[model samples]
Target chain A: MSDVFLGITNGVLYGLIALSLVIVWRSTSILNFAQGAMAMFAAYLGMTMSSHGLNFWACFAIALAAGFALGGLTERVLVRPLYKRPEINSIVVMVGFLGLLESAAAAIWSTAPRTLESPFSQIYFEHHSTTISLSPFALFQIISALVIMTAVGAIFRYTNLGLQLRAAALAPEVARLLGVRVNRLLTFGWMLSSAAGVVAAVVISSSGSIGLSPTIMDGFFVYGFIAAAIGGLESPVGAVVAGLLIGLVQQFLQDYAPSGISSFAPVIILVVALMIRPQGLFSTTKARRV
Target chain B: MISIANLSVSFGAVHALTNVSFDAAKGKITAILGANGAGKTTLLRTITGLEEAASGEISLEGTSLLNMRTEDIARAGVGHVPEGRGVIAEFTVLENLRLGSLAAKVNFQDGLAEQFELFPVLGERRSQHAATLSGGERQMLAMARALIAKPSVLLLDEPSLGLAPLVTAEMMATISQLCEKQSLTVLLVEQNAKSALKVAHDAVVLHLGNVVAAASAQEVASDERLRQYYLGLVDQ
Candidate 1:
């Protein structure tokens, strides 16, 4: 039961990152291998601000703004010219960007792991003289993830701006013929994606057990990508659901399975999910060309 | 009115269009007829700024369109329905119509009502995804999407492709009616010469990237050499 609660909390963090990846993928048809690194860099910026005597929320706000700026700049400077080029060109560039961000972070912050305490209490709540595994920080993570997901879903589903974004993503040339400004929308999509990534990174680093380092988000990114694939890269709701499922599965395996089996959980689940449903567990349509 | 003068386009060593010149008057249908590789599609694409012309002039109501972006050209009131319908298959009919209304200055509700009145079937299937619509419905939806913007000029490329003859005739009738009622400047590109000549007031025949004949629709239809060679309208 405690494991279930813990898994749900951690699962929301994974879902948040997966949502970010889906945003970028749906808009640009490019898998941002640098997404984790971007989040890490933003969190490092927040940590530095915290060290300078700023409050946690203030630092978080500044970090999110930095992430948004970085994302827009990246799209304009690096990804814009690669549009209509071969798919591999963008992929290679993103992989190169991942290395660049990591190296830059290490050079500036040094190799030592740093800690940033959550604003909320990390200690579990007690009920009837028994400690429940769910902490205030964990609850905050779940709530924040839900809020971000709802906001993003509303933007894509209800608004005129959302319609144009979806149209630009689905048929850019057609959208342009109808007078949609596709280039601007692409940049906006990247900004939103990176902001979501910042949320995930900050939440994960705030967990008491984890230490923040330049590559701290790399493992979470792997799991989030698997969650995105399981959810069908096109659907934000799917990503959240799959992220929760992965969290539950990993928790159960760690508690019940033999020694080293938990480490292979993500890969095993990914293979099984792909084998069962190649289009995606949540996807209604057939696999897209991209 | 839309005009193209001395327009030429090239891909590497191959010339897609060469000195192609024509004028499509307002309130009339001008059919650009040819067989495969006749530059019919290229000419329309260049006007909409999807394809660049090497050296030429394309103007819409006296405003130069040669250097504008595709979206800018659309905002300038040139609505182009490209080959393959270009409807977003994932979007619902209403959503597709709403996307078109983005560029329109008229009241959105009124524009939507007008579209529904013009194409009644679209209203019936407003909630359905475009992918589920039949060949005829998709074509109508594509045209209605362009019309919702109230574009002064409409460029249609291969609207009859893969459609049955009856549906093609019906589409042509609708287009002719729209042009008459709205006084739209229309450039209709088609490989189906027989059907195009039915609605066209003027016609231009292209063969090997050059205009072979330019005259009234009746004259082009009557010319035996153009009918047999350029349009493939006669049995050789």
Candidate 2:
């Protein structure tokens, strides 16, 4: 029961990161390998703000804004010039960007890990003289993830901007022919994606067990990517569900199985998912007409 | 009106279009007929700013269209339905229509109503993905997408490429009706010279990237040597 609660909490965090990845991937068709590093940078921004005596909410807002600016600048400066180039060029560039962001963070803040204080109490809630595994901070994480996911989903589904974003992604030439400013939308997509990543990073760093470091998000990114793949890279709903499933699996394995074996959950599940459903579990198969 | 003067395009050593020139008069259908590599598609693409002109003037009314971005050209009221209809297969009919309306900044409800009246099949399948639409229906949707913006000029590339003979005739009829009703300056590229000439007010025939003939559609259609050599319309 405790494992279930823990899994749900961790799953939502992973889902947030996966959601960020999905937003950028769907809009631009580029898997940003630098997403984790960007999130780390944003988390550091929040930590720095908190150090300066800013409130938790203010720091969170500033981190998201910073993420938005960083994402837009990256798209304009780095990605735009390589749009007509080969796919491998963008992939290699993102990988290079990941390294650059990590090094920049390390140079500015040092390589040492720093603890992030959670706004809510991390102590377990007591019920009938027995302490449950759930904490106020954990509850906050779950609610925040759900709210953000719902809002993002609504934005993509309901708004005119969302319709244009999907069109720009699916058929840019067609979108441009219709007068959509696809280049601007691509930059905006990156902004939304990075903001989502900042949310994931801040929440995860606020966990008692985790600390803010340049490399801390590396493991989360791997898990988030696996969730994105399993859920179908094109489906946001799939990403959250898959993230939760992965969290549950990891929690169960950690509690019951041999300690070392739990670390291999992502790899084993990813291989199994690929073998079973390479197109993703949630993706609808359609014969695309060119 | 859309005007093209001394338009030239090149890819490395291959000249796709060289000194091609024509004017598609307002409220008229100007059929650009040629063989597969006759640069018909390239002309439309260049006019829409998809391909940069090496040296030429392309203008909508009196404004130069060269050196402008594709989206800017679109916003400037040059609607192009490129080869393959250029519809997003993943989107539903309504969603595709809504995307088209975004550029015009028109009220979506009004645009949707107008397009539905024009292409009734799209209204019927408004919720179905465009991938499921038949070839003829997809062509109509593409036309509606361009029309939703209410552009002054429309550039259509091979709208009748894959339709049946009956469907092709119907599509051509619709294009003719649209040009007359909306006073649209239409530059239509087609491989089907016979059908294109039937509805076109004027014709510009291209052979190997050069305009071989520019005359009334009737004169071009009636010419024996031009039909035999360029149009592939060997007499029965």
Instruction: List clash counts for every candidate, in order.
Output: 0, 0
Candidate whose DockQ is highest: 2
Docking class of 2: high
Clashing residue pairs, candidate 2? none
Model 1 chain B lDDT-worst window of ten: B103-112
Per-residue accuracy of model 1 over B9-83 as CA lDDT, tens digit each: 998899999998988898899999998999999999999889999999999888899999999999999899999
- Give the alpha-carbon lDDT of every model: 0.90, 0.89
Local accuracy of candidate 2 as per-residue lDDT tens digits, A1-290: 89999999999988988988889988898888899899899889888988888888888888889999989998999988888898899989999999998999999999988867778999999999988889999999999999988888888889999888878887888888888899999999999999998998888778778877888888889899989888888788988899899989999999999997777887788789876887787766432111
Give me the runs in candidate 2 sitting further than 4 Å from their true place.
A285-290
lDDT of 2 by residue, B1-236 (tens): 88889999998899999998888898999999999999999888888878888998988888999988999999999899999998888889988888888878888899889889888999999999998999999999999989998988999999999999999999999999998899998888999999999999999999889999999999999999889999989888
lDDT of 2 at B180: 88
lDDT of 1: 0.90
- Candidate 1: deviation at residue B226, Å? 1.9
C-alpha RMSD values across all candidates: 1.5, 1.8
Off by over 4 Å in 1: none
Q: How well is candidate 2 docked (DockQ)?
A: 0.81
**Candidate 1: residue A176 lDDT (0-100):** 95
